[model samples]
Target: MVASKRNRVLAGMMLAIGFAALRSAPAAEVAAVLRAPDFKLSDQYGQSLSIQYPRESACVLIFADQRGSSQVEGWVRPLYSRYQGRVTISGVAELSSVPSALRTMIQGIFKKTIQFPVMLDWTGRVSRQHEYRGKAAAVVIVDPQGLILHRETGKAAVEALERCYEVLDGLVRTEDETPPTAPQDGPAVEQAQRQSRQNGAGGAVRQSDQAKK
Candidate 1:
């Protein structure tokens, strides 16, 4: 009789715990969205670049520390090949740990080695604002209005890459499916076709370069 009473009490406790979890689930789901922070920083080439919200195209920011820098190309090359025009991709290097004296040398090295612009975060202000992971590369996808839609940090694993691609694919498809409010003239149509061809050709060149490497 006593054992039966104890089991009943245990069951009641479990039921109450389950009810509490269910009650909290909706609150967790309704958490506020995260927005990307805007900042201006000089690239390796000493060119100024700024990230402003509500941009014309979606943006991808790749953040990496010295250790994580090696993994960046894995994410950048493929992303550039696939979404060059449809998305704006940028690289942010977290360099707060570097000595002040070596900063210029580091910038020069980046300029010589990297074909594209790499924004140098000397004080790590931008990286911290973006919640960058120091141990691995952090890839953030932001919508036109600057809301962070997806974030992946770590080695560019196949599954993570695929998830990023799915988000980009959906965004591009939605944009393509939207009906234009006004009819385009001949030049506009021709320009779009030319851009598409250019993108395809660029992707081919990148793939070939990767194969050669």
Candidate 2:
């Protein structure tokens, strides 16, 4: 009888804990001023870094698992280069399921190919704090005041990222003539086709080239 009573009490406590978690808003949406929490991890070169160190105008934290590396080259790599000094782009690898050596290998591939700072998040503490999910996730765009201007999830479209840069740049512009914030006029569908051929996405390359002429 005592055992049964103890079991009932345990179950009630579990239910209460679950309910509290459910009722709480996720960590990501919580707004705050001052410095964002710092995450320290080993980069590809085996050097340690935190978000607070090496201050820049902006920062991008990309939380990528193994699978997302495939797409990182075609898309993510260019952005890192484009925003190099202006924005510090840091990649965090979700290494829970991966071996340490294999994680290092994956980081090597990215470094050799993209040459950006990619960190390893073995405990997933950073991921959960920033509310990361799935294969590719990112956040942590801080303004000059050290306030986060954009904390987003998932890989947003290239156009969306472009718009973000434009707005941020505009904010710092001192000229009397400021450029109008244009709507998302994406690469013309036909133009993308032509460029895709030149860059070689590996389908209809020659045919697209002939069509472009």
Candidate 3:
């Protein structure tokens, strides 16, 4: 009888521990330090992208829809222009009412006008994961490690983007001091071409040696 009672007590303790873990799990925005959550999503080109991908001296900038403002096309476009290849720019549509076609067009417009990577987050999971507050906002300056290095919620003046660039550049300088690792895949776009050449040459070399034999 004593053993059975002890078993019951042990079970109760386990349940309490599990409850505590669930309560302590990180929630976006509320957590004190900004940690980037890894997520997989498709980009404008329908290519799979993940937060784990290594970036060379670049940051991720997210812009979302706001309540009062329809869309600040002019402001965002120039920011894209000035920073073009140096940074990856993405627009997140927070509203449930947004249509797929509209999202695609907006992405296309930015891809052409801004000439940078643009991503669509239909479920707002990315926004929530990043801990973005406010009905609509812009969160600029995510590091290559996917950490939220700097964030500005409201309408960021032209200076905001530039400031983010400075932060990222500083980070790159710091990383340069560290020991080297595997070869960088270079920028996100060039990665595909790099991989293609590697794969094509890799098999051809084996075949050529066989023919020589």
Per-model TM against the reference? 0.70, 0.53, 0.49
Model 3 residue runs over 4 Å out of place are 1-32, 66-75, 99-117, 175-213
Ranking by TM-score: 1, 2, 3
| Clash pairs for candidate 3 | 29-131
Query: Which structure among the candidates has the greatest TM-score?
Result: 1
lDDT of candidate 3 over 1-213, digit per residue (tens): 999999999999999999999986532231245657667666666667665535665565565654613444533666577666666666554544467768767567556764444465666677677765546566556667666767655555556556655665776667568776766566874988889999999899999999999
Candidate that beats the other on lDDT, 1 or 2, i.e. the better one: 1
Each prediction's number of clashing residue pairs: 0, 0, 1
Q: Tell me the RMSD of model 3 versus the true structure.
A: 18.8
lDDT of 2 by residue, 31-107 (tens): 35445566688777788988773353566666666665454444356666566566666677776776766766766
Top candidate by lDDT: 1
Instruction: State in Å the error of residue 77, model 1.
Output: 1.2
Model 2 clash pairs are none
Model 1 segments beyond 4 Å from truth?
Answer: 1-32, 180-213
Better of 1 and 3 by TM-score: 1
The C-alpha lDDT values of all candidates are: 0.87, 0.63, 0.62
Backbone clashes, candidate 1: 0
Question: Which residue pairs in candidate 1 collide?
Answer: none
